[model samples]
Target: MSSSSLPSSQKQVHLLKRPGRAPLSTEILNVVTAPLPDVSNLASGHVFLKTHFLSLDPSMRPSMDPSKKSYRPPAPLNETFWAGGVGTVIKSNHPEYKEGELVLSSAFGAQEYADMDVAATQRNGFFYKIDPAKGIEPREYLGGLWGTGLAAYLGMKEIAKVKKGDRVLVSGAAGATGGLAIQIARQLGASYIVGVAGGPGKAKYVVEELGADECIDYREANFEKQIASLSDRPEGGMDVYFDNVGGQTLDAALLAMNPNGRIACCGAISGYGGSYEGLKNSFVIVARRLTLQGYIAIGTFWPQDVYQAAIAQLATWLAEKKIATRFHFYEKVGVENFLDALKALFEGKNWGKMLLQVDPEWKGEGSKSAAK
Candidate 1:
């Protein structure tokens, strides 16, 4: 195959290794530049795609390992690894999709191009068409308005049962989900909001930027005691706890929660390594008669229409500026530094949403035509 005769090739970061319980490394992934694959198997109703941005969450780590049992399918080894992102339809056979339309991607991976079966993806409630008229950035669909927002919103609304005058406490407050949870808690009419973060900077960001009433540094010595010492204590201690990092933080929250408090268990980031220290204060659940429910945003929790309605509400808040979002973008040239960004996430380097901005401007044949 001569270079000119061969199809246009693009970059795809593929799964190379599974780290298991070990630390993440660049060696776990390999960037492969390859020609587009034949999608003739899907005879019709397919479209060519060009991806713009992707969402990187700690949950993706579980997707890389076959034995890990993540919410999404295991990313294929030596094949393009997919992350939820936004893309453009270059050409389409599906009636709902068309040429030059932005879409919430279900199959478009880290690569520059994809052949998506639109009807098939929509059936799974993953593919959504973006209305450019709204003037929303592609990345916004991956942040507080997308799965990131849904997790925070639904967790607070359905599981945490946060109500007006509720004193809400959120762990991992500086992270995308936690950050949004704090803001959403305030918007939900929580009279007092407390964010628990690892360091002073993150704590400050939680209060000063995300609008939490107070942010406690969990790293401080006897931090649980500090949480217990907040002045002007409400009639009841934290009425709701939005838990992200489990283990010690969760234990601390248990000690400070009011009787009958509700706990929304969103994530157990500290326990992802399979070595989380057991919680020492779990007896409070029985003594206080608290409600604790663990959840993931997809499946039983989010019926397609319900999720859409929640996202629409969040969009309204975003437009009204009643709630806001901050993003940490790794805008390296063409997804080349995805591994670096993933490493940064694990190191707690990002203060908000961790996003990958790949190929913002690719001058490939038909690329610009498709994006516009």
Candidate 2:
């Protein structure tokens, strides 16, 4: 039977064959034989989605490989890769969801549909309704307000306990979450925001484009010295360090943290190859009264006042153009480009959020007018 005619029970998924050193290519053909999904097994409030856009992020790499010493366990050897994604409703067995509505879910099976327990999925506690109105781009919901932006805002504002007049330092300052963290710091009235990126261009963009107070190129041999110099000019030493890259960048931030400073340890992308070593200045935390907290973006803070407050502020910022988002679109959605887009992330090739344009039913206002 044609895919269109196939019952919702027979969901065709793109499966991973095995782990390999070769980059993602069209020839990695391990995908076949997906079982049909049953939404009826899910609870009354639960809903299933037709997969639309799968998020490509740094955390996805470890989830793809079995042998890596990942912070989070990889998905079972031959199963689907689960992560954050937005999808449309194909069948709704629940009252909370209806046919054709879009919702975000963690069910990462690359099939057309997935069944999830309404209360249990997002069991780790983070999901939101995707509104298509309000003039905010659909992509922005995936990028700015939903996942990356939420991580950045929470890490800097809550976990790091950042205060006004504090000098905030963020490494990996050009990536999606890093860029968002920089803006949140500014919005929170941070006295100074310092960003460390891979190259001079990214460093310049961090300061000039992202509105950071200072930017340092971490590729420089004397990067620590530059940070020191910048530290001296303003409020010396960092009061809050929002780190995305671990390793040398982390080491330097540790050395430069002021007394009583706090660090929000979000990810260790530097150790993506699994070669992270002990810090040279591990004792700094004790000596400086520093609070370095490792953060995992999962918790029970659903519909909490803090979450609502942050969302409200972020929406206002976007509507007012006080906060802007940049994105690179991948026009197609097969496994070939899927792997290529992911590889580009590790190479630092994308300037902004990398999005795959699957099911191009909704375009901007121009397309809507033309269709009419």
Candidate 3:
């Protein structure tokens, strides 16, 4: 496609203002049209991309708050919100990149198009070229195969050091990373795996569909009792706890942990909506001698070899059908629905990895071939 034929303006979602303690609203995020990027003006090592899909994650909530301290910098007010997305390079001035090549980047804004500096993306440690021959869907890179999958792998293998015969418990078991963590624990030879999720349907999906040994509904009145009933091993408690919802669930898991247990604190979605339940059993960390560690999925935070090895192993497992991936996609949604899609995460409305399909016609390699 020639520059003259390309679009003059593109839709994008920008952070209009900082959200308060209440749930997110459209007032904080609004859709607007901006001038489309011109590849002819691209500097060296820069590429112009037409975004196809955008990833919606829980971590984005905290990043919107300038008061909150996190591994990543907060999103600036009145700017396009940062997100992980897959897009095709419409034009490129970089030697390493070419037009029509699909790539994944964490720097892509919640917009229809982007102008990327390839070297800067690499320097920030958040760029990947999607090879179509891999036989994996491009959106999977934003979910299980790359983003969420990598986080689960690093948390289990590196942070928790999960091993054979260990009793593993995963909180937020129906979410993207949580679901993958359950399967990863099973693959690592966990003798028993318990998944905690909200609603009966989600619990069933976690247990029956994801092959978890047991699933406990967090919304149940006897949530703690239900968890306690599952710790019937020789050690009398859980050996590994992969925590995604970190309020009372973390407290319950702490009470159910055996001596020398390991806890991988991946997220705290329960506390993201401006309220946090204090852990009543936090003293168990000292009494049980548990090792609790928090981690961020950014490449710079982890060793280079560890990241590559995990991705390689995850790719093999995916190809061999040992691990299954699921996505809850919003089809043909415009950038205006960005805040609504994000609200689904806190409300426990999404079944799996929540994603926005910016371009409904995109079909990965098929779309590329047809464009030719």
Which structure among the candidates has the greatest lDDT?
A: 3
Best-first order by TM-score: 3, 1, 2
Per-residue lDDT tens digits of candidate 2, residues 1-372? 122443644333343544444555434424454666554465576666665665678876665566656655665645555556676776667777777776776564554556666667666544556777777765677677776777788887779977789889998788888888898888888888999988888888899999998889988999977764554555487889998988877887887788898999988887664556568777888998999888665455435787877677788988888777666565455433556667678777766676554334534322222234
Compared with the true structure, what per-residue lDDT tens digits does model 1 show for residues 65-178?
867667777877888877777777776777878777878865667777778877777675478888878966566777867777888999998788789999999998999999
Candidate 2 matches the true fold with a TM-score of 0.82
Q: Compute each candidate's TM-score over C-alphas.
A: 0.89, 0.82, 0.94
| Most TM-score-accurate candidate | 3
Model 3 TM-score?
0.94
Q: What is the lDDT of residue 293 in candidate 2?
A: 88
Could you give candidate 3's per-residue lDDT for residues 1-372 as a string of tens digits? 555568889888998888757568878888888988666788888888888878898888878785555456888898899888898888889898888899999888899888988889888857778998999878778877666998888889999999999899999899999999989998999988899999999999998899898899999999987776555555577999999888888988888888899999998888776866788888889998999999987767777888889888998888888887788875335666788889877788888788877765576532332234
Task: RMSD for all candidates, in order, please.
Answer: 4.2, 4.2, 2.7
Decreasing lDDT order of the candidates = 3, 1, 2
RMSD of 2: 4.2
